[model samples]
Target: MSSVANWSCTATATIWRSLGKDETGDPLGYTEPEQILCDYEGGLSKKLASLGAEIVVKNTVWTEFALAATGDYLLIGSSTEPDPVVAGADEVRQVIRYGDTFERVADDYAILTGI
Candidate 1:
């Protein structure tokens, strides 16, 4: 099946992932997630990008990929964009979990697990 970006990403969410501060009170850096990162029901994973320091993640919503209407799997790096990314399966733009409530840790990134 082919990927589609037919849906408009009209919604936006602001999540506060706890970041550790240095002695000067600056962010040490973003944390990484353990287990599987999910968006809605979609399990998102990280992939390397051509752009320097940029990363991509899956935008899938179904456990079974074939079940999804279209593959829009996409972005994670402090993204200000409102919607998910639509790219190749081997490639992806990560997403944030709207329903997820993460257990903040010192060195841990935000894990998007939902009920």
Candidate 2:
């Protein structure tokens, strides 16, 4: 048997999801702040578009969260706080589940895009 170390960073941020617009065409809101263990990182790159526009590609800020023994609260399209208490800060992005098959050992990751 092997033991894995727990995450050293803590992230506290609001999780947001679009609940569709109201009759007046205004967007509704639903969010909740939660603290969880995670790791964060960011990078940047530059690329030229076909239209001769200089496009700056900020590397996706990846946030990895260890899976609980019970495997709960993991969903794609869910956004989390990119700034973990341990270090680094970035904008919120959609969640990316990191695995091909169903397993509790793998971690859940959030892909932060520069918008």
Candidate 3:
């Protein structure tokens, strides 16, 4: 299959990557990582918004950082998050799902749906 062209990774997203489970079994995460620039959409349809999809991020299959995960939280800016785990009232999108569509056609894309 032929490789598809890269998507417009123009949006700079500041992310707090999930560091897996901690010793106390609490969710642990930090912001030593930022996702490579990708397509980030802030708005969604009413139906989608009702379904908890507050924001959408479309990233390329190839990236410099790790793929998006369920526990990861992100803010669509260049600012860093000191403690996303303890982030209080800050409006950030938490990645709920990650999917990769690969094909010979122009459908190769990695998508991260956040809420």
Q: What is the C-alpha RMSD of each candidate to the true structure, in Å?
A: 16.7, 9.2, 6.5
Model 2: lDDT to the true structure: 0.38
lDDT of 3 by residue, 1-115 (tens): 2232354555666666667778898866554746455555544423245667544433222222345555666555565547654442123333333333455343323434333
By TM-score, how accurate is candidate 2?
Answer: 0.40
Collision pairs in model 1: 57-93, 57-94, 59-73, 74-93, 74-94, 75-93, 75-94
Tens digit per residue, CA lDDT, model 1, 56-83? 3333331111211112222322344333
Candidate 1 at 77: error in angstroms? 19
Candidate 2, superposed: residue stretches over 4 Å from native: 1-5, 8-14, 22-26, 45-94, 100-103
| TM-score against native, each model | 0.18, 0.40, 0.49
Work out how many backbone clashes candidate 2 has: 0
Best by lDDT: 3
Q: How far is candidate 3 from the true structure (C-alpha RMSD, Å)?
A: 6.5
Candidate number with greatest TM-score:
3
Rank order (by TM-score, best first): 3, 2, 1
Question: Which scores higher on lDDT, 1 or 2?
Answer: 2
How do the candidates rank by lDDT, highest first? 3, 2, 1
Q: Which lDDT values do the candidates have, in the order given?
A: 0.28, 0.38, 0.47
